[model samples]
Target: MPAVTVSDITTLARIPEPAPSAAERGVRSVTEAPTGFEGEGFPVRRAFAGVSHTDLDPFIHLDQMGEVEYAPGEPKGTAWHPHRGFETVTYIIDGTFEHADSHGGGGTITDGDTQWMTAGGGILHIERPPEALVASGGLFHGLQLWVNLPRALKLAPPRYQDLRAAESALLSTPDGGVLLRVIAGEVAGHAGPGATHTPMAMVHATISPGAQLRLPWRRDFNALVYVLSGAGSVGAERRPVRTGQLAVFGPGDVVTVAGAEHQDARHPALDVVVLGGAPIREPIAWGGPFVMNTRAEVLAAFEDFQAGRFGQIPAERVPHGDLGELPTQPA
Candidate 1:
């Protein structure tokens, strides 16, 4: 939960309060994420599970990586994989992850850091914990979101962005009740560092117990609030929510969330990631790892990948067992 912090939150810029006349969004549905294992058997919560594609347009999938404390030799990550027609945003709240792609886009992202990769046309990449971390064993928690690209940009050149925690636009409420890290798009008048193909906003908020956070939201974007830790309520109706739950908000100009008066000792505050994006509204054909507008397109992507169109792994690229032996920090 130490993604970013300040000694005096009041010293940070404050998000302006929404006007009284502004319409407050209502909660459409609250769903709980199911626990599962991903990659090479690392536990994950399917954050977007059971949610309709229409409500998650522009967002294809989300996985809440372990909040678990790993013992020595227990750390795991994904093998080299191919992706196309989408972007993958990996934000680390704790621990470290090393990424290397066939297109020469790779880096190490730690607490509060982010690695954004646009697999516009196609790309091959792998993510795993560094050797030091695997040897020492430690806590690891993070989120990986799959953002769908519009049909027009499906074959665009790939790109990468490494966003450090310091680059996030940090803000607080007038009362210092919450700390918000804007990772992408605009919040109020402040913008995050991520450059996205689709119009979207991503914010990580830490709300003190008994505090309420109300955000001025774009009317055209669909809103969603996913709880990362602790207990809380969402929307103008104040529907009860807790860790591993996601609240989908209806159309409105303001989105509201409030922390419970009390929380479990393990999680002292309410932590949530708020996301919104302009709907793509186009047909979606998603297969394992690839997201395309049509099934035929998805099939073509698999064919191209099998035919070596995605490029080969670099010769110098170390295999998984050796990955930990590499430098933990990005050079």
Candidate 2:
């Protein structure tokens, strides 16, 4: 799970310890993600499954993609689809993904890179592995998060931001026990490169064995911690959590997570993605690929899509698996 790493974590800027008066959040709930298939049959873990909508306000859905190694001709991705009324943030941790959309937002993102697509109003898009990757399969692991837009911004123009791994704000815990990659929003005095429509923070942290990470969190934003791999405990209560489990924290000004003393050989450290966002508190009427403030609006979105109002698919596309010759290894 090499998203981003440094030779010397101590050399990075350190996150300050929380103040004495800061309240430490308690673990509200811990739930395991259910495994499922997505796109064109690639494995995914529904990261936000079984989590309440109210607690997940501003953020609609999340999927931990892959973490699976594929053989040649086994790579897969989503077919052309349409989305509206939200933004999709795809973060690649260990593999490559090709994205193309009708709105001219497309790119190839790999190891630590991010593709932020605002599907406000409406747009057609597609996500797929490149032909080379399909021909010469390798490891693929990533996350795709759906962030909801407020009612006022539902019809905002579509936009895209390609955030490279180098642009991430890398930080370390005060004791240098953990490395944090801030993909979006601000942490302490440092901010990530992602510009979000909603006020939110996304951080991918790797905690060494027996290490702990304490973060000063926003009082207004809700907190959630999802373990990508290994074992850990969350919140001040130290609620035990493991791979594919999500821990939602209760109201507080600080968030805490600690890695267990032991881990399996496959995953030597604890990896987690911490997310928080200010509550939107608006009614959501989500259908298939559209998220709207009302049921009627969601119906209208489907009509528009069927009527060809979302724009047409591009003439050129990233091939799924039509390469003439298969490569012996990933390029």
Candidate 3:
């Protein structure tokens, strides 16, 4: 591991949108919400749980995947899409996903599976909805986060890591009602999920209502939280933060969440992701499906993709994934 640096660990958290007050709020219910500007075909849904990308050092985008229900027996496909200078991490909470990439390696990711892919330099891929979801018209819920690459690895080769849910080590603390699932980096005295290519921390936490979570913070790293499901409040922000929204916190000693009571009896848990890391601290030149450091670099990437530098996809190629299918929904 490298020594920590002030420039690398300094993070600023702000409540971009303060959570709603459950006390003053009226009874309400919401199902599918989507984020991200309109993507290509299929009306890229911002359907409603939160979707936005604030500051995650070296990371740019975060989309709260949904229970995308497709027609019976007809698999939903996102044709091929391209990405550069970043890696994509897909964490499945339920359902199944099948991805294929231009990098030449891909497989099915069922419930409890995680796929970390590096689309260094450039790659094209497609992620198709699992047939099971189409067959049963059930729910497909998960998250896909785009982690930007430091300048050093911007042009590195593309790669992938498929770790199953059962294989991923977990740390569950009943005392505080905290469930920490480590996707990368160390948490709660546990280590060795194989180091993430980027120096980062990705943890999925299920905070029980009235439970509290206090995580150590090192200056220089940016921090943000995505409320996955249920309603809850955060530090300095006692309002309710439900699905489909993000809480950008202000810099401080630690992040605190209190005064959240589950709305449903069967589901008394509040789910969210605590992601923070040193930012790349570089310019973001983004266009369509590509992200790079400069406009010129962005142009070059499109040229490569258009010229077929990255191979083509199969007949029913979907364009909603990065480098093909590792964790992309390239629609």
- Which pairs of residues collide in model 2? none
lDDT of 3 by residue, 87-115 (tens): 88877777677778877768888776888
Query: Would you give me the overall lDDT of model 3?
Result: 0.62
In order, candidate lDDTs are 0.91, 0.91, 0.62
User: Over 4 Å off in model 2, which ranges?
Assistant: 318-331
lDDT of 1 by residue, 237-261 (tens): 8999999999999999999999999
Q: Model 1, residue 312: displacement in angstroms?
A: 1.9
Put the candidates in TM-score order, highest first.
1, 2, 3
RMSD (Å) per prediction:
4.7, 5.5, 9.9
Which runs of model 3 end up more than 4 angstroms from their true locations? 1-54, 68-71, 174-176, 192-194, 312-331
**TM-score between model 2 and native:** 0.95
User: What TM-score does candidate 3 reach?
Assistant: 0.77
Order the candidate numbers by lDDT, best to worst.
1, 2, 3
- Candidate 3: residue 185 Cα off by (Å): 1.9
Clash counts for the predictions, in order: 1, 0, 43
Q: Per-residue lDDT of 79-177 in model 2, one digit per residue for the tens?
A: 777888999999999989999888888999999999999999998888888999999999999999999999999999999899999999999998899
Error of 2 at 314 (Å): 1.6
